[model samples]
Target chain A: GAGVSQSPRYKVAKRGQDVALRCDPISGHVSLFWYQQALGQGPEFLTYFQNEAQLDKSGLPSDRFFAERPEGSVSTLKIQRTQQEDSAVYLCASKLKAPGQGRNEQYFGPGTRLTVT
Target chain B: AQSVSQHNHHVILSEAASLELGCNYSYGGTVNLFWYVQYPGQHLQLLLKYFSGDPLVKGIKGFEAEFIKSKFSFNLRKPSVQWSDTAEYFCAVIRRHSGGGADGLTFGKGTHLIIQP
Candidate 1:
């Protein structure tokens, strides 16, 4: 793909249900990022991956949020026991270079808007 | 942890009006700054970026930003705005060397800009 692509443009889930969001990064992109954006707010970092390694998960808000990029190409973010507070847009981005290496812009995908009822 | 702050929650301007959006960060060390815009029904797109050497950097669509190291601010500017420019803008920063969790970006609350014609 020419750009990052995410699955499920919108999702409606009941409270306590589990939801999974998928992201397919551009080919050859070495870095992938996940972010959460609540209404009226900017996207906040949720986790980061360099290749298949989960280099940074410090930004994940809770233990229920889990992200994995198993093969360095596609990634999945799963939220267990969803809550109303979890309602937000989940964004996926990919970069061509490693962190701290040089200047590379992160290209974002059309995020999945999740609504927990 | 690094944090970003965007002062303007909402802004409105007429066509051809000059525009400026303010952004500040909490980290004191070396950082990379970026401005991203999200149009309605569209994905987030990079507007501009500032990394090293030059404090002023220009991006597509007549957007520019200045990185002020002394004040830890990266402010976005445009000489004129059109109705098509009405969108949400975000300021983001990446810590250069945090050792463990450096890859993910810290973003501000964003500014919702409405360029009225």
Candidate 2:
């Protein structure tokens, strides 16, 4: 793909429902990141992956949020028991290589706008 | 935890006017800074980044940012503005030696810039 691609550009879910958002990073990107952006706010880091390993999950808001980038190509962010507070835009981004080689311009996807009622 | 702050929540400018956006970060050690813009109905795109070397960094669309170590600031500027420059701008920073484990970025609340033609 030319850029990062996210599935279900918009999702409407009822409270307590479980929703999954998928992200397909650029073909050869080695670093993948997930972020949550609320209305009128900047994207906040959610989780990070280096290849197939989940190196950082400290930013995940709660137990309901889980992200996996198994196999190092595609990633999925799953939210269980979605609440109204969970409504936000979920963004996925990728970088060409590891974190700090002095090259860290992450390319972002259009993002998935999730609405929990 | 490193954090970013963007002071101006909204800015309005006319075409040909100069533009400036302020961004500050909180971190004791070396850090990587970046500016990203999100045009209406589009994904976020990197504007510029400062990892090392010169403090002045130029980016696409005639945008540039200067990193000031003492001020802990990386402010974006454009000598002239256009209607197309209207967008939401974000500032991000990552701890320099946090290892790949904390590779994810900490972003500011964002600033909305409106350029009228």
Candidate 3:
């Protein structure tokens, strides 16, 4: 089966430009998450979705970050204005269902490397 | 806020050498611990998890980790490593959400392991 996948394996943008990153979760996964990984560092949580509802956005850094999953399967993380600090690998992960159901493993995508110059 | 720590930023070893990677987290509440691995050009994959029951958890490809509450550690170990084991390893933690839904994970800086043949 196809796992979670992100679009545009690599993206380069000017510092003030806006960018939208897409994620396609596993076919039946109900939980999806986004993370950011800086060079030589680990990934940091960004946001989470349970179906179409944006359950958690606490991890989002600022107002510049917005995410939506209108159809409950495909998601998009939009940055209003790209910043040099935003240059990193953006990762997407999906799980089969809600947690505490005796199964809670997230499958990750190859991630999209975003570079803001 | 919860935070994960991976002491070793990089480790180099020869094939067949024993391997141990240190991981520690700080959170006063109950949490789920996880280990993820990313090979070159590949997405992050689950190595193992420790949710409940036995403290010692085993993962895929001859890997195991021990969760020690007292030390706040979950170090990964392999009796003998292969060159194929060379990759970046991450330690993550998820705080048990009271809402009965999934939560975002806090990850460490990650450890880059290089194995020579």
Winning model by DockQ? 1
Please give each candidate's TM-score: 0.96, 0.96, 0.96
Residue pair clashes in candidate 2: none
Considering summed lDDT, which 10 consecutive residues are worst modelled in model 3 chain B?
Answer: B95-104
Candidates 1 and 2, the one with greater lDDT = 1
lDDT of 2 at A114: 100
CA shift at A24, candidate 3, in angstroms?
Answer: 0.2
Ranked by DockQ, top first: 1, 2, 3
What TM-score should be assigned to candidate 3?
0.96
Docking class of 2: high
Write model 2 residue lDDT over B1-117, tens digit each, in one string. 677989999999999999989999988677788898999999999888888899999999999999999999999999999999999999998733345334878889999999998
- Give the C-alpha lDDT of model 2: 0.91
Q: Give me the chain B TM-score of candidate 2.
A: 0.93
Q: Judged by DockQ cut-offs, is candidate 1 incorrect, acceptable, medium or high? A: high
- What lDDT tens digits, residue by residue, belong to model 3 across residues A1-117? 588889989999999999999999999998899999999999998988989999888888999999999999999999988999999999999988866665578899999999999
Q: What range of 10 consecutive residues in model 2 chain B has the weakest lDDT sum?
A: B94-103
Per-residue alpha-carbon lDDT of model 1 for B8-104, expressed as tens digits?
9999999999999999999987788999999999999999998898899999999999999999999999999989999999999985335744686
List runs of model 1 lying over 4 Å from the truth.
B96-101
Compute the lDDT of residue A107 as modeled in candidate 3: 92
